[model samples]
Structure formats: C-alpha cells, structure tokens
Target chain A: MTDEKDFLSGYDPGDFPAFAVTADVVLLTMRAGRLCVLLIERGGPPFKGMWAFPGGFVKLDENLDQAASRELQEETGISGIDLTQFASYGDPDRDPRMRVVTVSYLAVVPDLPSPQASTDAAKARFWPVDDVEGTLAFDHDRILGDALSHLRTVVEYSPLAASFCEREFTVADLRRVYESIWGVDLDPSNFQRKVLGIDDFLVPTDRQSSSSAGGGRPARLYRLGKVSELRPPILPPD
Target chain B: MTDEKDFLSGYDPGDFPAFAVTADVVLLTMRAGRLCVLLIERGGPPFKGMWAFPGGFVKLDENLDQAASRELQEETGISGIDLTQFASYGDPDRDPRMRVVTVSYLAVVPDLPSPQASTDAAKARFWPVDDVEGTLAFDHDRILGDALSHLRTVVEYSPLAASFCEREFTVADLRRVYESIWGVDLDPSNFQRKVLGIDDFLVPTDRQSSSSAGGGRPARLYRLGKVSELRPPILPPD
Candidate 1:
C-alpha cells in the first residue's frame, strides 16, 4: 500500500495522526428548578482564568468511557453516575494545540455535593444553563449546545430521564424532570397518561408519600419500568 | 502539566497519540423488495478475500464526509448520493495495524447500477441484510447492526426512510421502503393513514404511474414533504 498506516500492512501503530482523544462532560442536574452543568475555571496557561467543561485527554490504555469516568473523578470528585455519550466533536481545528477529538457525554443526576476542583482547574461549580454567561474555553459552547439538544431528544423518547429522579419517586418528580430540562409547562394529566400508556413505562410500588411542605394527597411511588423507550413518543412543544 | 499532551500547556500538537480516523459506509437500496448493503471483497493482505464495507483512511485535509464521498466514488464509481453518518466505532483492538476509529455513514437510494470495484477491493456487490452470510471483515458486522438499529429507530420517528424511494413515488413505494427495512408487514390502509396523517409527510405531484406487472389503476405521485419529523411516531411491530 502507498500509505504506511494501512490496516493490511503491519505498520507502526504510532503512524496515525495520533489525535489526542478527550472526553468533555455536560454534567446536568435540576438545580433550583433549572438545568445546570458542572464547569471549571482553568488554572493553567492556555486559557488561564477561563471557564471550560471538566475534561481531560484519554489515556492510552483505556476506553473512551473509562477516560470520561477517570476525568470526572480526577477533576470534579464526581463519579459512579451514568454518563451517556451524545456526540463527538472533531473539526481538525477544534483544538488549537493539535488535532484533538473530544467525545462529549451528557450526565443527569439526582443530587451532587459541592465539587472539589483538581488537576488543572482552579475552581469548579455548577452553572445554570441560562446563567452561563461569557465564553467557554475551546469549542465547549458548541459542544454544550449539542449535548443539550441530544438530551432534549433523548428525554423525549427514552427512559433515562427517570435516572434524574430518586429511586422511589412520585409522578410529580418525573414531570419536574421533563419540565425542567424541556423548559416547558406540560399538563400533568396529559403527561402522566402518555407516560403510563407506554409499555412498562413505570412499575407502581407500594410506597407512597406526600410533599413535606404541605400535606397534599399521597402520591404513588414507582421505579423505572422495564421499557427503555417510549411509544407514540413524547412530542416536543411546537 | 505532568503529561506531555495536556491541553492546558498550549504544547506541541505533535505530541498527541494521533490515532487514525477512517469512514465506512453502509449503502442500502431495495432490490426485489429487499434491503441490501453495498460491500466489497478485499484484494490485499489482512482480511483479503473477506467481504467488508467500502471504506478508506481519511486524508490529511478533507472532512469525514468528504472522505466518505471520495472513497465511495473511488471504489464503486458512486458519487453525489447523500450519506449521513450513523455511528462512530473506536476501540484499540478494532484494527490490527493501528488504532483506527471509523465513523460509519448510512445511505439509502432507490436504485444503483452494478458496482465497479477499484482500489484494494477484488469484487463489489449488494448483499441483502437478511442474507448477509458469514462474518464481515473487521468490526463491520457490529457496525452494520448498529446502523440498522439506527435506521429502524429513525424510520419510526422521521421521514428519512423515503430516501430509499424514487424522487416521485407512490404510497406503496414509500410503504415498501419501511416494510423492507423494518422487516414487518404493515397494513396498507394503516400505513397510508399514518403516513398521510403526519403533517406534510408527502407532497402530491401531477405525475402518476401504474404497475407494469398488472394493468391496475394508476397511482398518484408524491415527493418528500416539509415535515422532517413524525409526531406520535410510527411504532414498530410487537
């Protein structure tokens, strides 16, 4: 073959462009009735004092998912939660230093303790999507937008949205998750009917609870049912 | 930074691992009312004589899409067809010679002339998805399965399945595309109603055609309409 990196030829594995692979996380949670992403302030020279998503180069010996978990644990002291990759950004020029292809994941959690910034980050904090003012480091702004769109698409058709709620949750908690992320006001009756209608959408349990703030009617507790996808899928607001 | 490839340092771009990026295509069409993919037999070492998806390493300059189009043109003499990437596969062991991550695209066309194999391929032909016997070279079997799953998922919620039909087609043509790809027997009446019910799923034109096999009533002609997505999506068979 004319090229040295040919799959047929026993060429040096290092002949590849060797683009540094990185994982950028769009860690989201419903904070104060809004969707927030965990971000960091760069403490290093390239983008000193600038904000960016918590991410790092993928290690040579690990899978991209493993690299993501490792980066989260190393940078934000947050791990063990589910992280679904939504998109991979690799516009040759996306990274200034070299050809860096970053796979971005969207993570929605029920609770998160205050993060302790490590590695090259000076500080770490959760920034509400709307309140995330100013520019983000590299192409993180576009990556965040892509992740949010993917999240919106995923929540509309998949059961992963329930992962944002407590193990035992009322319908209100599920409704709130959709409302917060979708930024819409869904009629509760219609939403519940649509969710329950999906085959195995939710499994009703014996546990019940009422809001601590007021003694409202006791709500049924349910777990994420056997269904991984919704049918007559949830349509986005027109 | 302790690591040489650290993004924070604004270091030399050359220090990154520079893994090779490639693109594979899953070109599908309806032949005798069955969905088939275009594949090639490798003529060179390492998987020589094995059937594989048409692909090549990305050039130093062109984007992934460009590279895919170029490869298809070079190997099969097919060009200008719209090919959308469905998934990207990257595992260190996926490729034997080097770490090559591939973005796989899926293209659906109404008809295709016999392929002219060039480059490293010894032969090229269309293989029905249901009849693809033996193992495909590399990780293509998994990639094709992923693309088919994605295609099934897309047709349920989007109108892209019409891409497999001629520019002007009848309702039966559109129905066959879905049925062939999904491997389901959709009720004609139900399929027609569901398709027409979706807002702007089809735009009727003045053209008409009758089946050559029988002297049947002429069927009305229609084209892809403005609606990009289907609400209350068409669910798959149980």
Candidate 2:
C-alpha cells in the first residue's frame, strides 16, 4: 500500500473539475380521474418562461433529500410531502452556464391543493400528464419521462397507487388511479377481482360512500393495507 | 416573465459551492453456495489500506453509467458487465476531503475469474458478503446495505436472480442463487413448484447436466425465459 505522504504528493483536491449539484422533483397526483404533474414556469435564465419541474441548487449544509424537500417547499409552497430519489442526471452539456448534475426525485401526493409559485418561478400549476406542452426546461423532459415510467413500474409491484387516493376510498376510485396512470380502460369486475384477491391490499371499513342523487348503490370504503408490497401484484392490462 | 438578461444579472455561477462526483460499484456474485462481494484495498489517503468498493471520480466527459463502468474497469480489471444504478449517497460529511456525492452501481456476475487490482487499488478479491470486516471507507457500508436490500426486493419481482447463474442451469442452480443471497434454506419441492409455476421464468433446453458419481439422475438444463418480470412473483419464505 502507498503511504499517506506518497499518496498526498500526487493528489490535489483542486486538480479535478467540480460540478454544481441540483435537486429536481417530479411531483404527481391524481385529480378529476386523470394523472397530473406539478410544473413551474421558469422565471430565470437558460430557459426563461419555459415550464420545468420545481428545483434548485443543493446547499452545502443540507443533504440531497433535504435539498429536494426544501426546494419543493420554497418554490411551490408544498411541504411535508414524501419524496423518492429516483435517478441522477449528469450529462456534460445538461447545463449551459456551468457543469451541473441534477438529482431527480419523485413525489406522489393524494390530490394536493393548488400550488402558488415563488422564488424564481413565475407560475406553478398541475397539468394533466397528457397536456404537458412541447419541452420542459433543461433535460427535465427526459427526467419527467423516466419518473413516469418509474411510477408505472412500481405501481404494479407495490401498493404505491394507494398514495394517490384519499384516506378512505372505494375500489373503483383505486381502479381509476390505475386506469388514469396506465392510460387504459379496465373491466370493473375484473379489476375488482384482481384487487381483492391480493392479501393485505385493502382494509375494508364498515362505512360506505354516500349514494349520489342518481340513486345507485354505495361502494364500500377501504383504507390502505399494512403491507408495503402487494402479493400477486396488480398488473396493468395488456 | 422575467427577461433572460435580468435573470442573468441576478444569478452568478460562482455563488453556489461545487461538489466532486464519484461512481462506486458494488459487484456481487455467487460462488460455492455463498454470496460474495468484490472489494479492493485502497492505496491512498483518509482511509489508506482499508477495503472499499472499486471506484473513483467521474470524468467530465462521460455520463454517469459510462463513468461507473470505466471506474470498475480501471480499478478492478473487470469489464463488459451489466450494471444497475441503484442509489446515490450525498451526506454532507460522507467524504472528508471535500463534498463528494457518489452514485453507486450494482453488478451481478456469474462466477467470473479473479480480479487484478490496478491504478489506486492495491489488492482486489471477492469477500463473502457476511465476512466484510469493520467499517469500509466512506459511507460504503450504508451503500452496501442499501444495495443488498435492493437485490432482495428485485429478486422477487424481476428475473434478476438469473443474472447470478450460468447461461444454462438447472432448477437447483437457480434455487441456490436465491438461498445464497437470501441466506435461507428453502424446501426443494416447494421451491420447484413456485419457480415452474411462474410463466416465462425458465426455458428448458434439450440437454441435461451429467449425473454425479453418487448415482443421481441428470437434471435438465434451462435458460432464462422471455419475460423480464415474474407474474405472481416468487415470495421469500416467511
């Protein structure tokens, strides 16, 4: 082994180029029977006025997750939400001003309230996943595409789809979450059979949803189950 | 919307601190019915002579995946293997030299030859996963734990376990891969039933392994099947 002194002789911390690190989040939710993503209109350079995921540079004092949460709160007024670190983007030319590497995070909210943009963003709004226009700021289009794919994959094996629903929801509500995200129509009975067959997928409550003025039968309400992963995973229709 | 010039006036590229990015690979393989991880002895400062994953700084020219593959080849003399980017670690104090954020990759090989250390690594060898001593350099211990958990989870849902076996293997060979990684003994009949039950889990070939001198029947050889994911995923025994 080389001695510390010998190693130090050849090593210089300043020799290598340093990179700027940023945390960007792709926040998604289900609203009005469709999947929506929170996008901010860039108020600053590089891609001014263009839509982008709310994000910012990582501070020296905070860790990556903390940076993600802080940026989400500072820019969009959304706080205390769970974020999953999905992927890191570091193309040499990703940022024009400098060499920047962005760590991307994914957040699934249960119908979050509207967001008010501040701190470098001119506007913030939830755009239906299909309604997202042209290109997003930076390489965010790629990042958002990856995040959506990650969500679709995890929803099959894990009970993550429940995160998009209210505390207590009917089986149809859960089915819609799948349908909207997968962009496919599913048979009601087949969906219900597959959902209920998975053990620990739902905890049924005695109370049922109130019948609408049309006078149809009420659907039973259920809470998210104990297990994080679903057995006999609810695969999307082919 | 803010004008590009006005946004540029307020933003300075040098205002935020820069970070050094690194790519570390956790290479795992099954040998002699034991789960082993590839480790290299560090030749330089902070943790000189300590065992660590083969890694180094990410170059300015390459993408994250390319950097990971390059680093693995440079330090350990292993190349052309598939790597999965599992997680990134960026605790402010992870590296003592400077603020370094490491993107970790996991590679599962099928009984490869021994590795020869080069560049900054003094020695390279496979260490049984359970036999890793003390603390590894930097936050590698936590990184390894996360990688192991990722492996365990994916083994249930994906055909990832097959990556640890030879191209042509028997049902017992595949089962041993699980038992070794999960560190549990499984009932042979039950294991065979579950594995065969999963559609597209294995493709049977027209050949079988030669019978042992102990006079046992030759087991049929099979290759990995068409599907990437398993339906009704093989759950680990309780």
Candidate 3:
C-alpha cells in the first residue's frame, strides 16, 4: 500500500475550494393543453449522454440573467422569450468531480418548436410534462418541481398565465392554460368573470379564432390585459 | 521579471480559490404596527467590522437552509423560527476575495426579544423597512430590496401575514398588519368583507377585548383560522 501522508500531501491544495457556477433553463410552453419543457442531452463526461436541463457554465463577466438567456438561445435556438430567475441549487455532491452551483430560470414561450442543440450536448428536444418519465440528471428533478410550483402560484395573482397562450386567445383558451398547469377543472362561468374582470390580466382584441371547435357565436378572442390585478384571486384546488 | 508561467505557478497557498458562499437572513417581525428586518455588525475581514445582514459560510455536506439556520442561531440566540428560502445571489465579484454566491432566506417571527451576538464579531439589531438609510455591505441593499418585494407579493396571497400577529387577533388587527407593511390605509368595510368572506382566513373566537380604545362595542377577537387562503387576496397599493 502507498504511504498515507504521501497521498494526502499530493492531493492537498491548501486553498479555498473553487466552484463552477452555471445557469439552467427550464423553458416552458403550452402544447396540446399541457405544459412542456425543453431538455438537452449531455455530450461531456460526468453524466454524459443523459438528459439534463439546458445550461452552461457562467462566464467570468456575465450576469446570471444574461448567462441564462445565452444558454437558452444557444441550446434551444430560441430568442426574445421572457425568462424569469426561479431558484439556485448548490449541493456539494451535485456534481461529482467539482462543486457546481446552478441558477435556474423559467422561460415561457408562445409556441413549441423543435430545439436544436447548440452547446455541449448530444441533442435537444421538447418533452411534455406527462412524458418526463425517468430520472433527470443532477438535481434537476427538484428544480423542475420548484419551477412548476412557482408557475402555478404566479398564475393565481399575476397575468403570467397569459404568457403561455398565443397573442390572441379566447377566454376558454386562457382558462385551459390555468387548468392544465393547476390540474383542476375551473368553473366556466366563474373563470370567465374572474379573468375578464381583471383589467391588466387581459385585453380584448379585434380577432376571433378561425377554427370554431366550441360551436356557438364564434368566441371573441382577447389578448393578455393591461391590468395586473385578478380582483378575486384564483384559488388553487383544495 | 516574472515569466507568465512562473507568475501563474506562484499560487498563494493561503489564497486558494475558495467557494465563497454567503448566508443572508431576512429577519422579519412586526414592530409597533409595521414589518421590520434585523441587521447586524460584521467583525470579520474582507469588509471587516461593517454592518451587514447576519450570515456565514456553508459547511461541506450541509444544505443552504441548514447553513442559514446555523448562521441565524449562531449570530442570534434565536432557534426554531419559521424560515423560508427566498432567493439566491451569485455575482462574480460580490465578494472582494472571490466569486461569492449567497442564498437568502425570509424568516418570520412574532416579536421575540432582541437578538444577541452569537457568531463572528457582530452585533445584531432590528430596523424598520422604511429606515434602511444608506448602502449595506456587499450588495445587501439590493438583496433587501428584492426580499421586500417578495414579501409584499407573498403576503398578498399566502397566509404569511398572520404570522406577524398574536395567536388570537381582531380583523382590524390583521388589517393593520397589511396596512403597516404596505404603508397605506385600507377601507375597513371592504377589507372586512374581503378577509371574512374567504374561508378560514380567520376563525371567530368567543372572547372579545374587555376594554375598547374609545366608546362603541368592544370588537370581537378571533384566532387565525386553519384555512390558509385569503380568498379575495389583499392587494398592495398602486
């Protein structure tokens, strides 16, 4: 056996540990009345070839938001999507070889598109919330859970739920976004009143859906309103 | 003259790149009639002897919350307070020595005795939200601003505001917590209807205040309800 002191002395650096900081993107979009997130394949060692959230090591000079935006654009080939910082993760064993802390961001896109891998990855694809079956790399499973909870909470008081809808969507369309994410069937009449009553929550548009799935007087389409308050806040399911 | 390789090779043994992580405590409590935060004095190097939010380094194998709690307990003799992870800060140059990432926590307490110094060379004290006069050390001022905004948003929908009041309180007393934090006078009738209509926001108690400040009937006292939802959420001032 090798001498213990020799081995220990060889490994000792005697300085404060260096940690690699990175940003991960949880780009969310509504697809088929469900929430979907973009996932990327890792090409590098240390969880190589496993599905992971889109992210990269933050550069020395970039801010956290800028790093997140850059990673999103590079990994997903999408730009100009509104991204909000969600949470940060820093478990010592999160990365096996090094200490890595990742700041997670939530991006709500208007439409779902096939993602192209741009950085250190094998491939990029959009996975439906229902289809995210297996374990995700790193501590991403926890991060996604936190992001979803934040999204549901935000939708109650803020107009962010509208971001998941198209430029001009009917009230029913808006309600679907809430119902799917919250996993609750809303009272149609009450939902209509609650959404329309909020001034900034939606804005009436001079547009209507070409496809009349719910036959009647063609439903009038409205965009996200300018008013922010949802007078009577939307309560989550008991 | 030192060569490039030699210059790089002369890494200081004491100056190893340490993962600089900070713990910021959003110590919140109701003072007089408004919400306030606790601040502390720094007695260590690298901003030695400056006033800052009470926090410290994250030990290996500990989660961020554990670190925050440990710091809170060490700095102040307080323990078992309800604390929530609020946000994380990871600016490259937030610390002078190296890149420091901070996980900030929001803690709610019901008027405890003043905090005593427990860890580091620091003194702990409480300050009102409106009285954060000048710049705080290490971008703490920005962190405080974000924490306040989060508190405002959280109090509107969550049952957190009641944490500031006693176990049993009046509708008027609860309303004052909102008014004090938001810094605006609320219409008693509208406020009462909004809070009472919500199921379980507050529970009716058989006890009433024995002495009224003025004439009129002694208003009924009620304990915080089991239900957490503030149905028609109390909105912040425009």
Model 2 misplaced stretches (Cα beyond 4 Å): A1-10, A115-122, A193-201, A213-215, B1-10, B115-122, B193-201, B212-215
**Model 1 lDDT, full chain set:** 0.76
- Per-residue alpha-carbon lDDT of candidate 2 for residues A79-101, written as tens digits (9 for 90 to 100): 88779999998988887887888
Highest lDDT model number: 2
For DockQ, candidate 2 versus 3, the one ahead is 2
TM-score of 2: 0.89
Q: What order do you get sorting by DockQ, best first? A: 2, 1, 3
Better of 2 and 3 by lDDT: 2
Best by TM-score: 1
User: Per lDDT, what order, best first?
Assistant: 2, 1, 3
Give per-residue CA lDDT, model 1, range B118-235, as digits (tens): 3454567888987774478888889889888889988887788888888899998998888887788999889888888888888989989766585777888999998877876888
What does candidate 3's lDDT look like per residue over A135-176, in tens digits? 677788888889998998887767888888778889888888
Please give, as one word, the docking class of candidate 2: acceptable
Candidate 1 lDDT at B94 equals 79
Off by over 4 Å in 1: A1-16, A115-122, B1-12, B114-122
